[model samples]
Each structure stands twice: as structure tokens, then as C-alpha cells.
Target: MSTVGKRGASSPRELTRIKDRLSFIYLERCVVHREDNAITATDADGITHIPSATIGTLLLGPGTKVTHQAMSVLGETGAGVIWVGERGVRFYAGGRGLTRSSALVEAQAMAWANRRTRLKVARDMYRMRFPGDDPSGRTRQELLSMEGRRLKECYRRESARTGVPWRRREYSPDDFTAGDAPNQAITAAAQCMYGIAHSVVAALGCSPGLGFIHSGHERSFVLDIADLYKTDVAIPVAFDTVAESEIDVATRTRRNLRDRINSTRLLDRCVNDIKELLDHTEDDDLNDQVLLETDGDIRLDSGRNYGDELSW
Candidate 1:
């Protein structure tokens, strides 16, 4: 008997909420294929089954083959699928989001379209990242300067805590191994955090390019979201990972970071933070529905033809 077919595609109401799903699932050197509603990863050891709906992001690392059916199930469940290099250090592509409502993305665009609103959102983001340090009335340049100083302090603090040698942040795009062990761990942790942020952004149907603070890049908003946890989560985790063992710093950082994110329930926090930042509330009327704009900012129900003779 063939085990190919299952229930029909999941409706928006049937999809899992982004906050409830796992932060991410990483697989490498394996073949991924669908079995019923679940996906199976086959490797030299054995086959492991994973429920598609539980995954927030599926990170396909190096040496992975995904069958069409696997992708199909993943899409149906609204999981973000990202292709990355070893240990998810390099990003290449990402899958679409699971949300059927355009409320969040629309709110994001509206906020981003205004200069003052954009700056306000940026300040709010900084405030969220560093609570007790008010960003109110701070110029953008001042915010950047403050962020740089805070980061330097974070690196120093983590280094002192973990007994890892403190050094200025350094990275080489051409080579991943050029950095010291702590630097490698930090870079790896940063990349993994980016993947998690991208997953949350995609799952919530938010635009990755409409960034408030960071800009001019496809994943600008992604960077902004990821940076929120850098000082507290990523930096600390990187130092701890390197301190624990210098061997395989990148891979170790990914594992430790994943655990920390899950333990901290960062995905739930991320979804909530994005919603709060965008000032978005889910509208049941807009879920899985499309509307057309009229001349006076009226919303017309879709699927009905307005006669051409109707004037604006």
C-alpha cells in the first residue's frame, strides 16, 4: 500500500500558531521524505520521524536531500524551511510563512512607511533589547553609539564570566575558521540566532526587509530581531560554549543555543514581541480573506465583480 496521500491541505484555522511551535529543527547528511503527515529523515544510522506541524523552522544544513513530498507537508504546516551551511552558519534561502492573515505585515508596512514611526519603532526595539536604559529622544546616531558600547561591555562581561579571552569582535566573510575559539562560537551563535529570528519573522508573515533600525538588506528586519537577544542570550551562550570545550565550537554553539532558546521560550517571546512592536491585533474577519480598497478607503469583499460602469 502506498502511504503518499493524507488529508487535504490545512486551512488557516487548522494551522499551528507560530508561538507554539519549536524554535527550529536542524538536519544534515540525511534524506528527508514525507510519510503521511510526518517527515522522515533517513541517515546511515536510521530513520527518524518528525511531526511537520510542530516545527517552526526546518534548517537544512550541509549534505541534506529533501524530497518534494517532504517540502509539500512542511508548506502545508506553515513551517519555515531554511537552507544553510554546516551548523546553520551560512544562510542561502528560506521558505514562506504560515500565517493566513495579512494584519501583521500590513501593520509593519504602515509603520515603516512613516519616517517618524520608523524611528519610534527603532527606539522601541532598542528599549526592548536593553530595558532600564531609555532610548527616548535619543538620535539614531546616539542609539548606534550606545549599542556599540553595550556590545563591547557584553563581550567583556561574558569573557570574564567564562574565563574566555576577551577580544574585539572579528569576522571574516571568506573564512569561518580565521577567528579565535570564542569568536568562532560567537559568530556561530549569531548566525543561529539569525536563523531563529528569520523563522519567527517568516512564520508571522512579517517582511524581512522592512527593518526599523537595520536597513538596506533583504534580512534587515531579521537582523534587528536577532540582535534583541544578542547581549543577553547569544553572547553569553557563545562564551559558555567555548568555555565548556574548545573543540567544534560552531557545532557546540548551535546545540547550546538551541537549548537555551527553547528553555527560555524565545519563540513565544519573539512572536509576542513582533506583534507588540507592530501594534498588530489579529482580526478574525481578515483571516484567510482578501479585500479590495475603494476610492474612499473602503474595503470591499473580494470575489465579487464590481461592474466596470461603477465609477470611482
Candidate 2:
């Protein structure tokens, strides 16, 4: 009983294997749990395993595996995992000194600037595409303009509330391993931003690797879109949560904040916004079939599809 797509087929042997190894993990709000770890999934069924090593700040979904080798493989694939729930997952990897407070501030500031730029671009595109239309078009254009303004205002207010000065400068792309505490925080915040970007690209049916702004990487587009959301969404959420709690920047509380960023309703709101943007796009093509890891079978509306039907 695996999810597949129409015109797709599942392999009987693979399906069985996946089903035997089936395990489900759930993370809601910043809490992670094994929903059904003991359940045996066959080869065809997909089971996501989170490495115990990265549990504090990160949570992987059911289709992933916990092994170091698996993680390396995933990173190589350029396909990132997303936590679909309210809180985005956060984790510190490789003992990199934590992100600096200033770095976090810088990241947020940059995010605000990026969001403003993108909104203006989007509005301009709309105006150029629908020139000389009726009042409806004009009204739509006004709404778009207003949305940009509102987002900018929100960024300003949030920055003030977080007590982080709005530094008007470009953020240097330093390695995560070199980040101090504040830098680590920035990285965590960026991870949430990336999640939003990934979701938007997914909804748009565009390759996250292929980006409009960011280039030369897997899911570069996602990275670009995520850059827009960090200041408006992820930054504010992370900053406010930390500030309100009066959590010590050096303590476990900061980690707690990072892990649970997705739990905030703000993250969910961003996801919804991404979905809406994608809905308005012209392309309607998407592959919704769920692949069964247990038996290498796919579930579609009509019936199970086998793996042999796949192109590769």
C-alpha cells in the first residue's frame, strides 16, 4: 500500500523491503519524536531515520536515514530535506563555533534588503506584463506594491524589537565552520530561510537547484527565495523568540530556539505564502505520486505502480 503516481509502477521486491523497514518520525513545533520506530518497513517502504548525532538542532523526516554515509549522500545529491511542520528544524554541525550575535543581526539586515529588492522586482515584472489593463489590474498592482511596503515595515519593526541594528552592508559568505556563536545563530536562521525557499520552489514545480538570483549550486533558486524570507519571516521569529524568553545567547536555550523555529506560526505563514505564490504561477505540472520504499512501488489514484515503469 504505497503511494504512487498515475502512469507509474512499483517493484514488488522493493516494496516488500521498504515496508519491512518502515519507520515514521514527527516533529511539531520544536519537539521531535519517533512516531513509529518499531514498525517494520519492507524495502519498498520509505523510512526516514535521523542520526542521533544531530538530534538537538535538527530533525529528519520519515524518508531519510540516520547514518553518516546517508547524510553525506544526501548532501551530495543537492536535494535538501524540509520539515513541513510549523517549526523548522535546526541543528549545529561539526562543532563550528556558534554564530555571532552580530552575524545574526547582519543576516537579518541582509534578508530585509533582499526581500525589498525582490518585491520591487516582482511588482515591476507585473506592471510590465500587464500594462494598460483595467482597474482590476491597477488594483492588483497596488496590492503588490502595498505588500512590499508592508513587509518592509514589518522588517523594520522586528529589527527594532530584536535590538539588532539594521546594518546596510552585504553579508560575507564565510564558512559555517568558522562562525562564532552569533554566526551559528545566523546559520540556524538561514536554515529556516532555506526551508521557506525550498517549499516555494516545490510548490512552483521548479527545480530548487535552479535559481533566479542565487546561482551555481543545487537548489540555488531555493537559496535565493529563502534569502527573501529570512529577514521578514525566519529572522524575526528566531530573534523575537529569543528576546522574549530572555534566553542566554550562550546556553542551550539558543539551541532550543533554533530547533523550534518551525514551531512558530510565522514559519507556517511563510509556507502558506510560498504556496500561494506558486498557485498564481502559470505552470500547473507537478508529480504528486508517493514512492513506496518497502517494495519500490508507487501509489497513484488508480492503483500501485511498479518501479520498472520508471525511466531509470
Candidate 3:
């Protein structure tokens, strides 16, 4: 008795690439249902149709009710589905990745497995965040020290630029309302960035837990990726939003961040940066192949029995 029974899930080639899709769509107080390939959100205003493949991340905020058929279409189209708190400042859960290939994940694991490569990748991350500063030959502790200084400098600079009053960064994870306007906006922006980064990381088939600089958390890599753009995108957007008006700071910050992300093509940059960081050269047709591991670091096509070729 499902509408989705008639249509098969979309092939990788059929779905829009993650980089080409919209940054994210935040929905609330609506009933989401499937209509053909698109998902429809019906609220008091009216029913709005959104093409499933066009979304990079679908943030279902508090009071959003999504149907099974809607989820099916979203999954088929490779859209990242996230459940979040009001105004999307808190994350509750996330859906699966888009990619069927293991190439990028394999490369990530290969890089993470070794100490030298992991350190190099960590330094590279810092280098990306701190342009004009060579992180080369720096120890992890030195990199951390540099990052701390740069972060403080970023806060000071943004405060001066936007004229938003800033003390130290203070956040209470248990209570969102505990922070001031600027702090609240910064937290909201950071949460949004995490969702966005998680979407890209998942789409690329990389392990979210395996991180270069951060460790032990399930979303360690997601945090690492999100921080790469925090100073450049989130912090500025948050400060600017607060400077304009303190009212509805989180909502305004989300809107401004979305616009900035789209205009700056952050999604495309995010994808490219991940590939570059992992030192991966992904084939265009990686999604099309199902490969099996063979002896001596080779791959064989999957789905055929190899027992006949292997003599007992």
C-alpha cells in the first residue's frame, strides 16, 4: 500500500551530484509526503513541492512530520536527512550516505592508519584554515597552539568588523538559551555547519569517526571538516547576523549562512577539499562498480564465484 512500490530507487547516475545540489533546506510545522519524484510539504500556507535530488541536506526541525514515502524518495535521490531542534541549532539524528563506492573510504583509512600520514593531514588541515602560515614541520602540539591563537584572533577580528560585543566563547550544551545573542548565533551557525559538513562527508563514503586532528567521537571527522570553514563562513555570518539585529538571531544566522554557503560554492569546495585532504583521486565511474579485493592489492569485479579459479 505504498506509492514508492511502483518506482525503483534511483541509480547513482540518475541522482544529482552532491556538489550541484542546494546547500540545505530547513522545514518545520509541516507534513511531508511524496508526490512522484518530488517531496511535498503541506502546511497552513499551502503545499510546496521540492525536488528530492536538489537537496544536499534536508533539516527536519521540530514539529515536522515526514512520511515513509517521502523518506524513500529522499533516500533514493541521495539527500541527507537530518532531524534537528528548533531553528536547527541542535542535531538529533542523520540518515545514510549517498555513495555506493568504497574508494574514498579506503583512501581515508589508508591515510588514518599511519602516524606520519595522519600528522601530515592534520598539518594540511591547519594550513587550509590558516593561510599564509606554513604548518609544515610543526608538531601536533604546535599546530594546536597555532590554532588556538588564530581562533582567538578570528573572534577579535570578527568582533571588531561587526561591532558585536564579545567576551570569551561560552556555550552550555545542555541549555541553548544560556548564551548571549552573539554566542547563540555562533552556536547556531556551528550546528548548521556540522550538518552541512556531515552531509558532504557521508556523500563521499568517508568514515565520520576517523579524523586527523580530532578523535574518539562518532562525528570527529565531521567536526574537523566543519571547523575548516568555521572562521571563513560560520563566524563571520554569525557576527554579521547579530550586528544587524539580535531578534531571531539563530534563524537569521541560518538564512545568511545558507546564502553565503551557496554564493561561495562551499559545497563544491568542501567536496574538493575532502578529496585533496585524503589524497584521493576518485574515478568518475566509482559508483558504477562493485569491486572485490584480490591478492596483492588488486581489485576484481564482484558478483562472480571465484571458487572455480582457486584450486583446493
lDDT of 1 at 113: 99
The positional error of residue 156 in candidate 3, measured at the CA in angstroms, is 0.9
lDDT of 2 by residue, 1-312 (tens): 221122133222212111111111233322222322111212343543443222221334334334333333223222233443222234222111111112222222333347554454344434332344222333445755654665466556766887754442223344433443333344556655555345334433445453434457766656655655555445565555555453343233234444454355443443444433333322122232433434345334445656576552
- Which residue pairs of candidate 1 clash? none
- TM-score, predicted candidate 2 vs. hidden true structure: 0.39
TM-score, one value per model: 0.94, 0.39, 0.96
Give me the runs in candidate 1 sitting further than 4 Å from their true place: 1-7, 283-286, 308-312
List runs of model 2 lying over 4 Å from the truth: 1-65, 68-121, 124-159, 164-172, 175-184, 199-205, 213-216, 241-271, 280-312
The sequence of per-residue lDDT tens digits that candidate 3 reaches over residues 1-312 is 546778766778887888988999899999999998899999999999999989999999999999998998888888999999977888899998788888889899999999999999999999999987999999999999999999899999999998999998989888888999989999999999999999999998899999999999999999999999989999999999999999999889999999999999999999999999998866542376788776677788889888868532
The number of clashing residue pairs in each candidate reads 0, 80, 0
Candidate 3: regions farther than 4 A off: 284-286, 310-312
Number of the predicted model whose lDDT against the real structure is largest? 3
Error of 1 at 259 (Å): 1.1
lDDT of 1: 0.88
lDDT value, residue 101 of candidate 2: 16
Query: What is the per-residue lDDT of model 1 for residues 1-312, given as tens digits with 9 covering 90 to 100?
Result: 244465476787787787778888889999999998899999999999999999988899999999988998899898899999966789999998887777788899999999999999999999999897999999999999999999898998998888999768889877899889998998999988898899889877789999999999999999999999999999999999989999989888888988998899998888889888988755432278789888887788889888885676
Cα lDDT for residue 72, candidate 2: 35
